[model samples]
Target: MGDHQIVENAPTRAWVLHPDIRNFGGSGDERPRDPARALEEAVSLAHALPGLEVVGNEVVRLPKPHPGLLFGTGKIEELKARLEANKIELVLIDGPVSPVQQRNLEKAWGVKLLDRTGLILEIFSDRAATREGVLQVEMAALSYQRTRLVRAWTHLERQRGGLGFVGGPGETQIEADRRAIDEQLVRLRRQLAKVVKTRDLHRKARAKVPYPIVALVGYTNAGKSTLFNRLTGAEVMAKDMLFATLDPTMRRVKLPEGGPEVILSDTVGFISDLPTELVAAFRATLEEVLAANLIVHVRDISHPESEEQAADVRAILASLGVVEDTPQIEVWNKIDLLADPTARLNAAARSDDIVALSAITGQGMDDFLTEVSHRLTGLRTEEDMTLTFAQGKQRAWLHEQGVVESEEQIDEGFALTVKWTETQKRRFAAL
Candidate 1:
């Protein structure tokens, strides 16, 4: 029955375990996250993958992780009994599990095991839609699989040699596996390079039209896609699920009250402890966020771990080398889901740098748009200049941009007052 269970139809019964390791020493800020919240996040991740029936979840407290087996022997036996009674087929560990630990745990429990990174990769594999997204996910999965090849093959100690004429020193099975993975990675990289080139051409074409970019970035399921749909009237898939929007989507949106039009970009949501393989593979896709003229960080204000999620997003942005001075706004989303009305009202009264809104309810959307317009307008520079009759090309360019607020013919030329952004000014200068 277990062997014949269909992943799409039968839905594997899964158990989630989050190890609350005491004195878990690591670099950086020392404050540890709440274990309960961490466990809740793991459960949510389990739900993110379709056809995974989360049968049970719990926090396994440990002074430290065991080297071979992640949990103590007694705890392992206890969980094994519980899994048998519940008929759980899969176990998901909410943190890193070494290959040795994973192999030992699966042997002891008589069930398949997956760690946080593995689960995330599976979710990405299921969610990726575009050709580039599929390629990137496959590359990342291959990279991750390469690391787990030790657990994958029992004949790693075997060796193979070439034909007599070409034979040198024989290669071990593990070396052959690693070489194959590396070759596949090279091929994928070549294909990805071509796709990226085409995407770059598209970006160049957009730059010619040259609307300022406003990118939405946030933790998974933080309502970024919802807000993007509200602003742009786009039909992008927005769900209360993690990683709902995998590939970045862009649409031209006119700001509130007939303000300037800007390109709104909805990017893949960030997560805490995102897989290193995925981060490297998706760098090309994330370049959109880096090029944005403005970044809107959406936060799920109703979630208990919102602050932690925001920190994760910021840390990732920093790793991506987002300029410190890049224009950004904090959007407190899902306010309608907040339990306290008074608190929600207070949140809505926050400063311009922060705006509270309910993307699902369309509340405070106008205010959010107003804030966006105000922020973008602040980046513009207005100046007056003189152009001679011979400078007809420049005059026409200014009119084309609709930045020529006022123009008057003078004795030897035309005096013009123009309002434009730095990018627009640079483009005109190039012209």
Candidate 2:
């Protein structure tokens, strides 16, 4: 079964939305979707969800700085009727709702309720596989949950593992659990700090090698991991689920025709309306992008919203201060899924350094690798020479420090053709 099919079977009813605060004249920015756009986006998100079915959904429209119920009384009543008629079990508001407002909405609807922040946290928690990633996700979740712990049943303030581990006598278990979660949050942050330090050391070491770091970044499920795997021979988890990869993975890959090895990094992908908490929590991990010698903005050429996705990625990168001076090459991936593949290829190839290729089929891999090799080596080449077999030390150093392209046996000695950087060439020149 496909990866998406596995998600499709999970049992849950998820309602989603994209709130347009611009309509309230918050900043005077015009939104084409407005409230109507939110409903459409919600339905689109619902349809993309795997396993658990969406029973019913309604986008709760809100004005700027909504005090209580985000929607007007009439709109709330309309949603109430729809929920009752449809027997909806959950109400998911597509924006951050305060704890009091969330509780009030749940009580009125007589159903569980979640805001966009909570939903995104749940998705991140579910998708995180590595220990470090899980710690980071849980840290973000606890930070979000802290504000929503106003009510007693919220179980937001109990510390476990002590005689009076629970909250005050009148407080419920939920309150105690929340407190425990908060304590765990502190511990997790310390652990992640250590991980960050280790990552920094790796970065320092990588700098000594002088290989250009090429980072693959784009919208979630934008074929980044696929392209990374294709380029680096790594088996990182690649799936259709959102946030499938939370931790960055780097591998040294030799480009085609035997150029020097380059460092390639696969990073967690971005989304259009990513939660603020997640962005803040993942910042430590995202520092990898800032140091990238080159960035590959990978896009799924087949997605209907590819342009929007690309714009979102650029916006996020610009926000993080990583795009100003760093060089970027747009990679339109998954052309195998598109009709008139050549047309798509031609379109992407317009950029000075763009390449269109199918990572799965190995199509255009040669052209793609050649471009990569050129970028990493800065348009340099090597010379061909022959040396006596007795030059054992020189031969070994050439093999170790430079890329040996071809070797042949001759009666006098050996014929060796190799590629090396300018520094390496100087080092070999003395020999």
Candidate 3:
């Protein structure tokens, strides 16, 4: 994802720029995002990567972006002088940069260039702990690189282990590089399929267990891990950083007061402007959310852009085909960080659908738990289901759940009458 050449023990000096082109149609963001906040997020993304020390950052306001160089002559000269004065080695553009524009900018400014997608891919590659996660990141990076296979490999080859894809000479070299990337993608897909199959097996195993699955989802750094740890007492990496927990973690939690036992899943955080490649690559991992019986949407209510962040999360959820019928609870986490949390919480208390709490302090946790128990107590209905001769797993799962009241063997397979809650119905449908 990144190709910045750095000396040992020396962080790569990088400059961050967010091009605020006035007329530019916001890419995936349907509504306008605050430019200052957007740039702040960009800088945070830069900070998320380990080896880059950001020297300077700016919100470059423009009427429009230049297709050839992104910035105009005056702005280019201005930024170039700043880069040289600061001895910046890499320029991180906080938005999409066409390959031609990237090459021209690098040549003119005498610095290596990386865009938002590249930086994120680098961070994922660095932080991906699970084997599936690593494979997905590699596949996504390869796909991203396949399109931008035109940069000269002056120093990238020495830094990133012979990626050798970018900056090739001519049409022949570019075609060869693309073919190589395709081959790598094919290999990764096979590996990923096997991993996903294993994951699915685990999922089916969980379905047989007598516990409903609850998934926690929210924007990055929204305190999901903290809340999960509070509920389950698992030592997940909970830090004040974007993407502190990349891969999903699960724990079986026994509710207090003889409430229903459940499995709590903490998933990768959602972010605005997440690269499309990552969205597609991580879909398999995210299917857990779909299989969940309840979704707890944790939000950082103290942030000024909380509503916008929630909107982004919801948008992504909708894109993933999460139906509106799914049971959900909105959690306003980190109330301890709020100014006069009393009034803020009082306002939040107006809605039964929302719960405001401090995960670290354990405030309002009882109410949250009580609400979860209340939601999980869904009405059950009896229904008849039929299974084919080859569907032994499904038939066994239905019986294992203790929901089947009667079963009759038939020529096609078996017919059963079962009583179950909406959550169980959804889970069975998934199978």
- How many clashes in each structure? 0, 9, 3
Alpha-carbon lDDT, every model: 0.84, 0.71, 0.85
lDDT of 3 at 146: 78
Ordering by TM-score: 3, 1, 2
Estimate the overall C-alpha local distance difference test score of candidate 3.
0.85
Candidate number with the higher TM-score (1 or 3): 3
Mark the regions of model 1 whose C-alpha exceeds 4 Å error after superposition: 1-8, 27-29, 155-171, 347-350, 382-419, 423-431
Please provide TM-scores, in order, for all candidate models, with all chains considered together: 0.84, 0.71, 0.87
For model 2, where is the 10-residue window of minimal lDDT?
A: 152-161
**Over all chains combined, what TM-score does candidate 2 have?**
0.71
What are the runs in model 2 whose C-alpha is more than 4 Å off? 1-10, 17-22, 30-51, 57-66, 84-87, 151-186, 205-211, 232-234, 302-305, 336-344, 360-363, 379-431
Give the top-scoring candidate (TM-score): 3
Prediction 2 global C-alpha lDDT: 0.71
